[model samples]
Target: MTDLLPLWRDLLLGGFILLAYTTEAMTGFGSIVIALSLGALILPIDDVQTVLVPLNICMTGFLSWRHRNHIDWRLLGRLIMPFMLAGTVLGYWVQPVLGGALLKVGFALLVLWFVLRELRRAARGHVAAPKSGWWSRGIVLGAGVTHGLFASGGPLLVYGLAGLSLDKARFRATLILVWFSLNSLLTLLYLNQGRLQPLAPHVLAYLPLIPLGIVLGERLHHRVDEVTFRLWIYRVLAVSASALLLASLLQLG
Candidate 1:
């Protein structure tokens, strides 16, 4: 293990780190999106995963606490534990095999596929939303696996929740809990596998950013209307995801 404080690794990278958490705090998502995209731009893919995985633990943990009560654990049992448990192990195993570039590419594709599918359904007025059920186990399991794989499970989940008749805060809050918990668990699992590295100094550099961003996001979220917020989030997911995928693919080529 080596630590190199290269000249290029400065406050801009640190600012990029804050963007993720701030986005998350505001919208209940975007930390992973910001981290993965910005990290890929400067750090190697492997380094990105190792570095940001820990940061994910912190950001998600905070959000989880904020949204703790919103999570429906009875419904959570239907989807989270069994679903992610398997996916968690898979995430650890897949990292070594796919390496960094492939993981980025894979996440991009998954995000795109889900987002566009949601868009198409919305266009056709087929967006019906998520209904709580034992019947929805298949979707929940599949969503868990996707979350396990990329932590970008938001595309599948966010859209799914939108289709449900849930209130705005409840939808976003539950997502915060789900993602924060699952990402934390995956990080622990990855550490056990020795794929995740400890990045204390790295995390410390941007630690202040998460809280700052969350505060700002909360401000923005309160100011915006629900319908407008959802629309903007979808747009962000589509555009941010497209940009990340294109950049990674270009790098690969």
Candidate 2:
């Protein structure tokens, strides 16, 4: 594991953290997916995951607390949490055998699929629109597995949440709370496996920047209209997906 403190690396990683969490703070999700895709371009994938997961846990925890009163507990409890937990445990167990290059390709494909789906919906004048009665056990479990394996499960879970038709505030609040719980479980699995300890020093060093990102993200969240927000989010998803795909191809070549 490379030490995270070589000043330039710290600054670069710090910028990604700020950008990722700012998205999270605004949209109630996206931190992990955005961060991992961009950070992996500079740092090793495992190293990026090492520090980012813990930082995400902290960031989502704070967001969850801030929106505690608005959480859609029924949806979270009955539909999302259970399968996500099961998938996380299972994915963690399977992670060691999964090839990094293959995983990146799969992640990029999945993200692009989501982006196209959202764009199609937007073209139909349905931005931020939720589909009715699309919830299922499989989507939840798949989200957990992806989150467990790649730390980029937010897109899957976010799409699922969009279908449920909760108001924007409640939707964001519920997503944050769900992430806080799921990430906590994933973190515990990491600890039990002895993976988190090595990343602590870097996490500590980056702690100061977290609050700044959160504050800026919250402000951005308030300023943006729902339609415009969804547009920018899909655009970002497309860009990040493209970047990750390019990186994987370059590595293969």
Residue 138 CA displacement from its true place in model 2, Å: 1.5
Off by over 4 Å in 1: 1-7, 99-103, 120-139, 160-162, 193-198
Give all TM-scores, in the order shown.
Answer: 0.81, 0.90
Q: How does residue 252 of candidate 1 score in lDDT?
A: 83
Per-residue alpha-carbon lDDT of model 2 for 31-102, expressed as tens digits?
A: 877777778777887888878888888888888888899998898888788878887777777888874777
Number of the predicted model whose lDDT against the real structure is largest: 2
Error of 1 at 250 (Å): 2.7
In model 2, the worst 10-residue window by lDDT is: 127-136
Cα RMSD to native, each candidate? Answer: 3.8, 2.9
> For each candidate, how many residue pairs have backbone atoms clashing (under 3 Å)?
4, 0
**For residues 128-222, could you state the per-residue lDDT of candidate 1 as single tens digits?**
65655654554555555556555656665564445565565766676777776777777776677676555556766766776777788788878
In model 1, the worst 10-residue window by lDDT is: 1-10
How close to the true structure is residue 70 of candidate 1, measured as C-alpha lDDT? 72
**lDDT of the structure predicted as candidate 2:** 0.79
Error of 2 at 54 (Å): 1.0
